[model samples]
Target chain A: MKKIIYLLILCLTTSIFYSCSKDEPDTANSIFDTSAPELNSFDQWLRDNYVIPYNIQVKYKLEDIETDYAYNVIPADLEKSKRMAFLLKYLWIEAYKEVAGDGIHFVRANAPRVMHYLGSAEYDDRGKRLGVAEGGMKITITEVNDLIPSQIIYQEFFNTIHHEFGHILCQTIDIPIDFRTITPADYAPSTWFNRSDEEAAELGFVSPYASSLPEEDFVEVLARYITYTPAEWQAKLTQAGTTGSELITIKLGRVKTYMKNAWKVDLDQLKAVVQRRAYEIQFIDLDNLGF
Target chain B: MKKNSILTIILSLALAISCTPNIDPIFEKSASERMTESVENVKKLLTAQTNGWLVEYYPEKTQKYGGFNLLFKFDGENVVVRSELEPLRTDSSIYALKGDMSTSLNFTTYNISLHRFSDPSLNIGGGIGLAYEGDYEFVIVSALETEFILRGKKTKNTIRMTPFPTTIDWEEFCQQILDSKPEYRPLYLHVNGNDSLWVSNDETSLTMSYKKDNVEVNKKIAYMFTPQGLKLYEDFEYAGKTYSEFILQSNNNLISAGSTFVPRVPPATWLPRAAFAGTYTLIHYTNIGGTGTPYTKTVTLTEYDNKFLLSGLMPSLNLDVVLDYHFGKGILLARQQGLRYIGGNSLNLTSVTNEFGLSPGAFYIGQQVSWDGVSDPIELTWTDYGQYGSPIIGFVLWFTNSAGLSVGQYTTGPVDQRLWTHIKMTKQ
Candidate 1:
C-alpha cells in the first residue's frame, strides 16, 4: 500500500510540473511589441512636461488603436505637434497652475490622462467635428496642423481643452446640482448646431453648444468665460438682450459659487490668467521653446 | 493497483512530451526574431534605392478619385515625398516601420500630398465628412528588389511601389502631360482591326463610349500620368477591345499596351461648326487676373450667327450686360462693338477699361485657335488687354452635344504670363 501511494504522489507531482513549466507556449507575450517609442526632442519635451509631471501621455504619433477606425486620419505634423505642445503647456497647464496656486496638483489630479493630437478632424456623418473627450480619460484635438496661433483660432481650441477638462473635473466630483437647475428647461440635447450662439445666448446659454445638455452647458459657460475676452463677453451679453442677459448673469453667479465651494477654484482668477495667456500666445516663439 | 497504473501512464506521457525540446525552428530565428528581421529588411529595402520609388496610390477602396503618383525618397527616419498633385513641391516627413498585428509602413508625419487624401476638410473622394478614405499606414505585403506591393491598413487598397530610375525626371514627365496640348479630338480605339471604340478625355478623366447590343454604353475611368504613360484606374473592355495601359508616342498618339499596331486614333476635327452652337450655363469661372477667385454663376450662352450671346451678369464685373463673340473653325473673335447694356439697348464700349477688360471684360478680345476637336472643341490663344504688352493668352474650350444645341462643357487657362483661369460650362 505504501509503494502504491508513493507512485500516485509522484505521478501527480510530475503532471502538475509539466503543465506549469516555463516551456509552455506563450504566443501572446512573444508577439507583443516590447519596444519603447522612439525618443526625439519633441518626445522628450512631452515626457517632461506632460508625462513626468501630470502623468499624461501626449500621443502625437499616429496609432490606429487611438483613432477612430471609421474615419480616416493621419498623424500630426512634427513641427505642428511641437508648436501645439508648447502652446498647450503655456496656455492650458501653466494657466491652471497659476490659478490653482499648485504647479501640478490641479492638472495632475483633474486633467485627462491621454492627449491625442490628430492632423485632421474626425468628421462624422453629419460633416462636423471639432474635438471629443472620451470617458474623461482621453481628449482628442484634431486639425492641429492648421493652427495659426491667432486669437480667434486659439480661443476656439482653448474652449475645447477647457470643455474637456471640465468633463474630467465633473467626473471626479459631480457639478453642483444647483448649476444644472439654472438652465433646466433650455437643454436642446440635439439640434443645437442648428442654433447660432446669439440665439443660444438669448435662451440663457453662453454658446450654441452649451444648450445641448446641462453638463455641456456648465462646461461651455466655464470654457467660454475663461477664453473669451472682456469685449467678447460683453458682446455676448448684449446680444442676449435684457431678459436673457439677466438669466445668463444669474447662471454665471451660480457657476462662480460652485467652483469656489466645490473645487476651491476661483473662476475670475482663472479667467484672468487664461485671458492673459491667450493674449500672449502670438508672441511666444513656438519653434524655439528651450525645453 | 489499477489507479496507480493509470497515473503512471499519464505521468510517463507528460514527461515524454515535456522532455521533447522546442521543435527546431524552420527558420533559425524564433518567430518574434524573424518578424523583427523582416521589419528591418523592409526598411533597408526602402532606403536602398538611390533614385527612390514611385508609388501608385489609390486612396479609396471604391477607387473614386482615381490614382496618384508619388515619388518617395526614404532615409533612416525620414521620407521626402514629391507629387504632381502639389506641383513642384517636395516635403520631407517622418516614416516608421511599426509591428502591429503585422509590420506596417506608416507615414507618421504629415506630408501634404500623402495626408491630403485623408484630410477631412477637403472632400476629394466623394466620401461624406471623409477625405478620400485613404490610409497612411500600409502593410508591406511583399517586398522585392524591383517592386513592393502594399495593402492599406484602413482602406485595404493596393498600392504598388517600384524603383524609379535616376535618368527619368518624374516632375518633368508629369509636367509634359499637363503641358501637352493634345488636339481635343475624339480618339478611336480599333480592336482586331475591325470594331472601333470612341475615346474622349476631359483632361482629368477618360471616357469611352461604345455601343453594346445596340445601346450606347459609356465607361468613364479616372487616370493619371505615369512615368511610362497614362495608367487607367480600371481596365476597359468592349467588343473584344481591352486595354488599361497606354504609352504616349512622339506623334501624340497613345499605343495600347502589348501591341505594336494598336493605336488610339486622335480626333480629326470631324464636327466643328455644330460644336459651339448651343445654350450653355457657366458651371465654373475664375478671374485669375484680379481677385484670383472662382465664381459659380448662372450665366446663359445663346449661340447664333457664329456668335455667342452671353446674357447674364459677369460675377467678376458684377454687371448685367450682353456680350457677343464670333467663333469660326479655329478662331474665336470677340467683337469690340458687341458690348451692350441690356436695359438701355445701347453699346457701352468704354466700360471696357483695363481692369474691366482684364476682368473678362476682354470679352471683346479675340483668341487664336490652337487645337480644334470633334463636336466643336476649340482651344483659343488670346492676348490680355490690361497687361502692358500683348502677352499671349492660351485657353481650352470643350463642348458636348445636347438635344439640338452643343454645350460648352469645360474651359481652362487663359494663362496670362503664368497666371491662368479655369472656367467650366455645362449645357443648360
Candidate 2:
C-alpha cells in the first residue's frame, strides 16, 4: 500500500509537470492575432522564416494593427499595406544599391517583425528601426489616423524607408565621425524647415529640405544620388546660379570615399543596382490618378 | 522512484527550454552610415536635363551672348560669342567660339556675314530696285589704313571697326600716341577686333584700326555657309594729315582681289560691313521719343519654330516689338510696329513709306545662309509700354532647329527720342 501510494503520487506529479511544460506558449503563434486577417501573409512569413527559422523573439501584437508600421498608417488595409510594401521595397532597392552591390535580402515575415513608428529617433510614429541578427527592422511612415491617399502613398512610403533605413546603416557600422563634423553645429531637429534655400546652399547642400539633420542630410543625399543623374545635378546647380561641376566632383568623391572607408562598400556598382531597382518601383502612375 | 525522478527532470528541462525567450539585439545606424544609406537612396530617384542662355549687350548696339546650346553640333560646350556689322549691310554674322579668351588675340577680321533683303521697292512703289542678289558676303575687318575721315573742324582721327573687343586699353595706347590729350574712360571696342586699337584727336572723331594678320577665327561665323562682304581702309600719311582709301568687296572678293591702295581722307562709316558702334539713326521722322507723353503698346515675341514665346510693352510710341533669337546663329531678330502702323495685313509696319513705323531687323555678325533666296521675311512679335518704368516693355523673339532653340527679349532704353532698345537672349 505504501509503494502504491508513492507510485501514484509520482505519476500524478510527473503528469502534472508534463502538462505544465506543454502549456509553455508557442512564441511563434503568440504574436499572431486571428482577428487581423489582413496581416495573414505578413504573420505567416514572419512565423516560418523570422520566428521559426531564425528564432527571433519579436514584441508586436497583430491585433494592434493601428500603431504598427507607422510609416504606413492605413489600418492594415491590405491594398494600402501592399502598396506601401511595394514602395518600401523600391526605396530599399534604391538605398541598397549605393551601399550593397546588388540584390537585397528579403526576409520571411516571422523571422523578426518590423514595428512602425516607435523609436524616439524616428521622424514619425511610423518611423523605422531594425534588428540586425534575428528580427529584421521596423519602419514607421505616419500615424494611425494620418493615412495618406494612394496617390502619394508610394512617395510617403519611400521617404519613410529612406529615412528609417538611414538609421539602419548608421547603427550597423559606425559612420565616420568626420561626417558629423562637416554637418555643422546648427544641425538639429527641423533644421530643414528652419533654414532658407540660400542658407542651405552656403553649406554645399542643394535645398533646405536637405538641411534637416545630420541623419536626414545623409538620407537626402542618398535619395538624390538614387534619383538624379550627375548631369541632372549639374543642371540644378545652374539654376542655383553656379555650375554644379565642382560640387558634383566633390560630392561623388565624398560618396565613394564614405562608402568604402566607412561602410566598406563599393559605391559605383551600388549605383548601377540602385538605378535598376528604382526603375522598377518609382511613383509614376500618379498622372493616371487624376484621370 | 528513479523513473519518476528522471521523468520529472526531463519535463523540467523541456519546460525551461520552451519558456525561454530569445530577444534580437536592436541595430541602430550611425549618421555616417545613414549618409551612406541616404546616398544609396538618392542614387535611386532620377530624372532628365534642362538648358538655357544669357546675353549682354553694349551701348553701341553691339552684343555678346554666351550660353549652352542644348541641341546643337557643339553640344555640352559653352559657346561664348560676339557679332559685328559689315560696311555694306545691316548686321554681320555671329562669330561663335568654343572657349573664353583671357587676353584679346587681335581684331583683324570681321569675317561674319548674312544675306538680308534691302528692297526699297517693296514699300515706296519702287526706288533703288534693291534685291538680295543671292547671298552677299559681309565682313567687319580692320579699318583700312587709308580709311581715315575728317569728321569735325578738328583733326580728330577716327577709324571704322566692326563689333570691337569688349576689353581695350585706350589710355595706354593713347599715351603711346599723344602725350597732350589726357585719356578719359577707355572706350570699348564694341564691334569687331581681337583688341580694338583706337585713337582720337580734338572732337568726337575716332579712328579704329586692326592688323590684317591678327584675326582670330570665329566658330559661329563659320557654321553659316553664306556670302560675307568685307571692306577695309588702307590709310597712309601723304602730308601732315592722314589720308585713307577703302575697297568695298565680298569676303570672297577680298580673298580673290588681294591688292592694296592709298587714300586722301579717313574713311568714316563706309562698309560692306557696318561699324559695330556706328553713329547712325539714318531714317528718322516723328521719332518714337518725340511723343512727349508716354503711351502703351503690347507686343508678342515668337520663336522661329513657333515654340518659344514672350511678350512685353512699349510706353512712348505705343508701338510693339516682336523679338526672336536664332539659336543656331545667336542673332536677335526683331520686328517693330506702331499703334497705327499697318499696310495690307500681317503687322504691315514693315513698310517704311506707309509710315508703318516698323524696323524689321536681324542682329548678326555679317554672314548669310541659303534659304530659298527670296526675301525671307523673318517673322517677329511686338508689344507697347504705356506705363513708366515697366520691366521688359518690349519684345521677345525665338528660333528653333533640330539642334535646339533660343529666345531674345528687348527692353525700352532710357533714351526715348533715341529709339534705344536693349536686347537679352537665353537658350531654350
Candidate lDDT values, in order: 0.66, 0.32
Q: Scoring only chain A, what TM-score does candidate 1 earn?
A: 0.88
For all predicted structures, in order, the TM-scores are 0.71, 0.28
- How well is each residue in B344-381 modelled by candidate 1, as lDDT tens digits? 12222221222323223232343332223433333322
Tens-digit per-residue lDDT, A201-269, candidate 2: 556565555566665566556555545555756655654455333443455466567767655557666
Output the lDDT of residue A3, model 2. 75
Q: In candidate 2, which residue ranges exceed 4 Å CA deviation?
A: A1-76, A90-136, A143-156, A183-192, A229-232, A239-252, A262-264, A281-291, B1-428
Local error of candidate 1 at A130, Å? 1.4
Compose the digit string of candidate 1's lDDT tens values, residues A1-291. Answer: 768766766776776667664765666555555788578777888888889988999888788778878665667988988888888888888888877845569778878888899887776654446788888889998888877776533436668888888887887778888877776887877566556567788998887778889888888888888888888899989999998888888888877887787677899998988778877877767667775
